[model samples]
Target: MRIRATVVAAVSGALALSALAAPAAQASDDAVSRADIAKVREAAHAASSSKAAFSARAAAYDEPYALNVTFSNFKIAKAVKVGTTNRVTAKVTYTLTHGTDVDITAFDFLTDPFLYKGSFAAPQNVLIGDDFGHCKSTSATKATCSGTIDIRPRDYELLNADAGTWKAGAWAIAFNGEDPGADDFDMGKVGYAEKGGLATTLVQRYSKLTVNASPEPVKKGKTITVTGKLTRANWEAFRYAGYTNQSVKLQFRKKNSNTYTTIKTVKTNSTGNLKTTVKASVDGYYRYNFEGTTTTPAVKAAGDFVDVK
Candidate 1:
């Protein structure tokens, strides 16, 4: 998630003053003085400088705090269809062993596609936790967190440009003592831990199927020609295109029946066109069903009614 400039400035200003004060012996004593607010302008300037430096060197810096934090039991949906709503969840169990007594205050789970190349863009914020929901400590050194990430249609827009595997990781901010003041915080106090072997792939496609049976109301035992076409989203052209050489099923449902039975299976031609013939027997509905591929979602066309004479 992208942080708003104003929010970042506010947080940076608060943390900068905290950086100037002496380390509190106890978390309860970590209060800020009025003098600290007086230096707000100075703190803000310093914060901007620090941000600039961090951005310039962030790619090369391997966050040290990650070494002390570990994540496990991570899980998420293996696949999601394009243009659909989906939810992803993960269980994060972390141990803060860097210090004998570390107090965590805030944290968030993030997913970044490998395409980011260490850039700030493309990292989707998953779940955020404070002393509230989705995060709880079992012991001074151990904590467990779990939460669901709702993916909406707008969120899928992120994949409109790129699609592939993405990695999940945790970013946490911890204080040395409970109730620590602002000055007690620093970039060094944050941690980022990525779990290996936990990745999800995204495919950029959707499918469409259609069907029609000709010679309606024909004599019984007469041949009925069924034709249809299959198409899928073309990411490059931003349009739907024929999906050739794919297997599709021709199904029929009697007028009074709710279930559809497969009449025959046929493969698409070079232009994704479907052509088949079946003997007219009774009043029924005909449709085409595409089972779908790894890159596309399954689809069934609306039933076309056929009258029997």
Candidate 2:
């Protein structure tokens, strides 16, 4: 059986290169100028620090935590229904201290809903893998590429936990590492706190993942089975094949519809296929689209579009 993807809805910012950033001491409390913000944004774009990677014996670290994570281009391509699942995407970047205990392991950047039963000193976030939530590669590392986390529609619950109120722009992200040994670095801790130097009060904005949906102009209102293919064009090999969760929701928007309505949703089979089918409801000049998001090898667009008749 195929499972639905989790839907993520949040607000966050990303890197944008401009000539407004001025070098200031890390310890200084001066106001951040537009130029400084642009420089930081440029660095975030250059490093691609948010994507996932694989590492065998990379550096490790401990103690005074250090991670600088920035997420931009936040959007919700296809929002999840009351019962089905969906995906969300965002750009991420970060910097951390390297050491022996700081085993820079690999991880899947997918996001999922987690339950915390531990106290503040020892909080525990567990991903409920029932749906297409929080699925990624186990061999991901920092040496490969920046990581992207895919959160399901229900994963927002995990981000909202441990807080008293749910603010409009406040959110949290947890990274689950690929290491399992006692001496290895903790994936969950590294992802949330150690891996990306972000404030405990983090925020993410919503962006759109456009899926082209169009019907054959000649064969208006045709009932053909439409198949769409999604692939990572600008990602490393390990990061590309490591993302086990490729499920997607196929949707359609009529000539003048304002919102995307979900027509069908499907989970990728074991062979890495995020395939789904839907019947055409509109005639000529219709739009066919798919809405999805993830962290591992973040996919920008839903491949290409097709014409139906």
Best by TM-score: 1
Model 2 residue-pair collision total: 60
Kindly report which residue stretches of model 2 are placed more than 4 angstroms away from their true locations once superposed: 1-215, 218-221, 232-243, 284-294, 297-309
Cα lDDT listed for each candidate: 0.49, 0.30
**Could you tell me the TM-score of candidate 1?**
0.56
What lDDT does model 1 reach? 0.49
TM-score of 2: 0.28
Cα lDDT tens digits for candidate 2, 108-132: 2222222222322122221112321
Measure candidate 1: CA RMSD.
10.6
Q: Which stretches of candidate 1 lie over 4 Å from their true place?
A: 1-63, 84-102, 107-189, 199-204
